[model samples]
Target: MGSTHAPVDLSSEYAADFRAHQRTLRLGAMTVWPSTVQPLLSRRTAKLVRCSDPGTYNLTLVLEGTARASWDDREAEYRPYDLHSQNSWQPCTVQVGQNDQIVRCVGVEIPRNLVALPRNSADRAIGRPLSAREGVGALLAGFLTRLIADTSAYRATDGPRLGAVLGDLVSALFAHTLDSGRELSPEAHRRTLTLSVRSFIGRNLHDPDLTPSTVAAAHNVSTSYLYRLFQDENVTIGALIRRERLERARRDLADPAQHGVPVHEIAARWGFTHHSAFTRAFRAAHGTSPSDYRQARHQPTSIPERASGGTPTGSADQVM
Candidate 1:
């Protein structure tokens, strides 16, 4: 809302019944906000923009219902999975939801200077709907969704690094749209490519034939170039693949629902062709064999009693 961009004036015919839920995750200077809300019309007038311009850009991906945004004589309508952006320095209006329907979306806010695009070029993208169904946009959408879904998995120290990755992905998507991909800084390109390659590896971890060469080919980069991409990461491409596969297998083994499944079957499910090798790697990484790890994870412990119980105190005016 206004916390990321300029404050807006909001109204709705369904005002009496309006309600909203929003969860915010701070990623260093960037913020990820996932919200579900009733229908409303919001406007950021020139006066508001002048009074409070954080010099940031707000990118929104609609996950449900619909919305329309307009600024500088430009207007665009967005449906589920579609992306649209608004600049804090601009005056804009957004009408979300319809016929009392609820709207859901994830929004990202980053400093304008971090985008690695000229101010004018970036402004041209405001209020323009970008497709999040494929390419870098899809990758970004998935990254944001995962971040919001499991904020607890990341430590506070990971925020700035995560924000940099998001910024690189956003810059790449915008550059691709403007046919200026070549203009991105070398670091931005490298970071974006690294993220893309990691995402690809994650999706294909179940393929036993997956290797560094195959991964490079899939991304249209040479094997040597792929190695160079991960130079700063301190882990080779093959090691990264192996580590990810082992991590996935470890998670499955620990799931109580899969406890009845054989350890070898769990290993094979994550592309481990040899049970012995899987066992060795799992132990090296976790200090325990897969079976032992699963046993320890599934062990039950007595629950602690709550010191006190009462209704949670919070304001009903928690509007998104």
Candidate 2:
């Protein structure tokens, strides 16, 4: 959640202790060492040490020379673009070669509450190692990259908005990692359904028969479920359709080309079957008749210009 950068010196004197110290850092934070040069002697000795707290969970992506991590009684070799994670407060040892290495990594400390899912669910979703090779991994990597790059622009005033963005990104990442598809969480599924329903409604705005049932059928969901999903948003499916149609008509009437088109034709084009109904609704929403509004918009320019004579006389049009 917070980040800072400092130069690190990994020499023989402090290398072992540093490794031991890293193993105890909190799980919720991660460190990224961009690039550093290693002395030849350290490479030959392979005296690199890395460790993390027992309750901490972290992910590391190696971008350079060979490196290995020891955890869970097993050692895993890391290659460029390779992702690795750990669950529980356990020690992890990482060995890197002497050649200059560059690595860009993100470490996440999973919260305690999140660690308490059903045994099998936890193991599959959170407790075990998760790879960032696809889907949510890709999204998280991109989001973190942008977050780190734009940290300065995200101020206290922008906390809620930024927090929402982060929360969505985390939800998406976890959902993909769990492989629960659309069945994982009700909120996640609702978000997806809402997006789909909105898209369907927008595309079918010109269809006069586009109703809640039709939209639900198009997405293979029941009309009741569709209504339930949008309940919290405080708008009904029927209202959305009417609003979209009126919006389209309002836009067309304001356009110069549609100036020559009849108001009723514009209404019909956007799926309004009855002109009188459309006019009444439009007036209620906009506080003006469509024709009057359109004419007012086309009022002439107020600037005046001088009239020109056929030719300029030598005496400047004087009576001389």
Candidate 3:
């Protein structure tokens, strides 16, 4: 990818090797760029080559620090944890701050065909900010962030599977931004809900009150409906929540920094209420009590979490 850039200050031609790491799955790709001061990447009309690969809708997620983007008659500001989508075919400029502010992000590109939205509807959404504060947006953000942070935890077999999930997430997110004006297919609708439920669960992991009923209420769905949705996955919503909570607690216990935090406190931090109940659950889940698990130098690992996807919306493939 021979991409070129110019400094925002117009002081001179931009020249800097910014520290950016990128990874590509079968259907989606993620690129992480550490914060930098200058050399903003610019893709103008002269650069969106017609002979390149099909264009995609790329979502730039600002994990840390603030940044900005510009494209076809539009400009958008992004801060930490903000997901901003743009058309890969459209020319754009992405700029970040200087001073080693440490801006890091994972970009997910969604193929246009996979998005299932009208061209105009899709166009209307470019470069707009999608906050990871609540709803499906938060869920997708968490999934993408986790995927980038723990890519090694995923096996080759999980690629296509995650891609499909990523597509569903993108559809849901697009629909969300479109409000009720947009229509999602039956399958996309169900999947969107499932991902929403999953996202809800993830966001509220610390809340002991995060139950199926509460989650259903948040999404305006019945508890039974929510249960049915996750039923076939062989993972009850309760089980998923418990699994996530336990996993989080287990990791916290394993951390030497958390050593001073008591076992009961740690359990409660992840939603466990009763000390005995928490201890029992911890022991049952990890084959040892939280206290012992924390004290032990190397605790036996448990099951890893699953993943999700997005698509390519960048690179005309030439930028020397």
Candidate 4:
């Protein structure tokens, strides 16, 4: 599916009559824009938001300006390209700068079941403004941009998959924010630990020796608890390791620089040791043999044939 609506001109269309012109568009179960306006937001005074009904969570991305956002008596200035999420039910104010600013944001109403934290949790999480500068924030920004760009593909049938992506992104962002500040609680600690473990696993994908015992020891947690941590994520330790390793191999194979590297070496670099075993795994994962993949990447027209007797593997992609 794709968007049929023309690009919106919020500045001219809703510049005046702020109350009636506030636009809200539903994108799947989530709402994309709720009462968004460029003019109603300014730097001179704090803008108080009155939701039609209590919303779950308000996700905002700073498209082209800087401003300070305040929730539950805490505040922080957000610069261009920064992303922030807030609990909409709580009374909050956003202060913009003197220059006209443009912001593109999407707010997702937090589901009832996930909001079962103690009363202070929301306050603690939103009280101090959170910035999406790294980790989950970086992933969330990319995911949300992709989501909004391809709304049709993220329909009812794809809800579960999309929801999982959203959950992981948000979990990572909030967990990072809470841990960096002094306000993290016991529950927050657990959530942050889970995200950290996942991130560590991702960064160590090339290490063939990465294992449950290694991960558990790195985090100073027992093997049983590490398994338990991933239970809620619908995956196991072994599953994550495999997924990361395969993903890395796929990326390296696709790189033009690797046109000469032997498939066996590529596999070994990412943990696979045996030539036959790596070929089988690559075929199963990518539906193509490693030699075929290399040949396809180095088609005669795309890559010049080596002069004399130089092996293709002697080029950039090969192991020295």
Whole-model lDDT, model 1: 0.85
As for candidate 2, its clashing pairs are: 22-51, 23-51, 23-52, 27-56, 27-109, 28-109, 54-88, 54-89, 54-90, 55-89
Tens digits of per-residue lDDT for model 2, 188-260: 4556456557766777898999999999998779999888888998999999899998998888998887799
Q: Model 1 off-target regions past 4 Å? A: 1-5, 150-158, 276-280, 283-320
- Please list the C-alpha lDDT of all candidates, in the order they appear: 0.85, 0.55, 0.68, 0.57
Error of 4 at 173 (Å): 5.4
Query: Looking at candidate 1, what is the lDDT of residue 228?
Result: 88
- Measured by TM-score, the strongest candidate is 1
Ranking by lDDT: 1, 3, 4, 2
Please provide, for model 1 over 1-320, each residue's C-alpha lDDT reduced to its tens digit, 9 standing for 90 to 100.
55545688899888787799988777778878899999999999998888788899889999999999888777899999899888888788999988978999998888999898887887776665588898888999998888777554465567778888888888888887887878788889988888889989999998999999999999888999999899988999999999999999988987789999999998888899999999999999999888888887887653233666654332111211
Kindly list the per-residue Cα lDDT of model 4 for residues 143-230, writing each as its tens digit: 6565555343333445544554455455545655566323334454566567667777877766778899999998889999999888
Please tell me which predicted candidate would have the highest lDDT against the true structure.
1
Error of 3 at 71 (Å): 3.7
User: Which stretches of model 4 miss by more than 4 angstroms?
Assistant: 1-29, 32-51, 70-74, 80-91, 96-106, 111-113, 135-146, 164-200, 217-220, 228-236, 254-289, 296-320
Q: Which 10 residues in a row give candidate 4 its minimum summed lDDT?
A: 1-10
Off by over 4 Å in 3: 1-12, 16-38, 46-53, 93-103, 249-263, 279-320
